[model samples]
Target: MSLLLEREDATLEIVDDSVLTICGEADFDSAGPLAQAGRHWLAEQPAQTEVSFDLTGVQIASSAVLSVLLVWVRSVQRHSLRLNRVSLSPALQRLMDITELAPLLPAVETTCAEPARDRR
Candidate 1:
């Protein structure tokens, strides 16, 4: 895997030409740059490349993280790339479930070690 962008609390890396892995806290402060970099990277990939977003390393899965994910999703669509699956953290899965935005993403895989807790 090759490192693409690295901030203090977040890192975006290309697992291969086909998979992008985002690790750490993708907070509101990092959202804009993360989205822009992710979009640019997606735009550069060949259309035949199937894409996956690996967010299992993210802890918060805040709205900012979702925003970044959405931007990357749109970028993939615009580039005519196929989205395979989004590997998610437990927190991210919970956030998506709460927001009802799961359908906006492709197939999801909960990859984090900890399971999402029941808040209710």
Candidate 2:
């Protein structure tokens, strides 16, 4: 795992060079730097074709956090990388649901410990 950006209330890191895990609280005060750092990290990774974001550690899902996620979405597109998954925290999920942005984010609800099974 590699540390990408660290703020007073949050941290961004890349795990196995593919999973970007964001933890703690983030607001408008920290959004810009977080987004900028994410872009830089994406640019530096030339061998990564797919990426996943683990936002489950986030404690505060503010609009600024959503903005950061959007920035990441755009960055991955600009870098010619596929966004394989985005694991959201309950707070983030509610924000996405309220904003009707779930479709845009491609949220993944499965855990990595086991294979995804059919519910029906």
Candidate 3:
């Protein structure tokens, strides 16, 4: 049997009002770390703070990663915190469209300047 390995490179920046900008690869195996960091940041913030996910650097996101994102959104909603300013790659946007989850998440700006081929 062969083992599979997944790697994720992500950076988290805490903006005002507890909005955290997440940039980097959010893949199947890396979703856990990303979610953990997000949750940790939320816990550190005061009540009624928003957490914005910036996907400018995200190259690829698998279904698992999307699921993680949904879960995080739900958690934030439950806490009465707001979620805004989510960016996604074209591939991810397509996936969201296919799954009809785009309406649930915040509207994404389609200004990602990175080439599709360059993203991975």
Candidate 4:
């Protein structure tokens, strides 16, 4: 929707600290690739690694996304890995809340961090 600016259908990025960011829509058309990729990443996390799912840029989140998230949870448990955390935009947070799925995953409030200033 507006968050996508209709420019990006979906995007997947793995940033620093192994944060997996899923941008744009997390719908039927977009969930497959994400799930496939996510499974790969999740399989590798355990024994002192942290992985977070950053859905802050997602515009539309549907059952498809929710299902994928559920799969992630199962993966975490399956691998006995500690999920780092989940970061959600207000919209995504509300979507999870509406579906009563927020409690299923350990998510923290997505607050802006102060920019690091150069001390030169």
Per-residue lDDT of model 2, residues 48-82, tens digit only: 47788877777787999989989988888777777
Best-performing candidate as measured by lDDT: 1
The residue pairs in collision within model 1 are none
Which residue pairs overlap in candidate 3's backbone? none
Candidate models: Cα lDDT each = 0.81, 0.76, 0.60, 0.66
What TM-score does each of the candidates earn?
A: 0.87, 0.83, 0.69, 0.75
lDDT of 3: 0.60
User: Which lDDT tens digits does candidate 4 get at residues 5-35?
Assistant: 1224676767675777677777897777777
Q: What is the C-alpha RMSD of each candidate to the true structure, in Å?
A: 5.3, 6.4, 7.2, 7.1
- Candidate order by TM-score, decreasing, is 1, 2, 4, 3
State the number of backbone clashes in model 2.
0
Off by over 4 Å in 4: 1-8, 107-120
RMSD of 1: 5.3
Q: C-alpha displacement of 1 in model 1, angstroms?
A: 1.0
Instruction: Please report the TM-score between candidate 1 and the true structure.
Output: 0.87
Worst 10 residues of 3 by lDDT: 1-10
- How many residue pairs clash (N, CA or C atoms closer than 3 angstroms) in each of the candidate models, in the order given? 0, 0, 0, 0
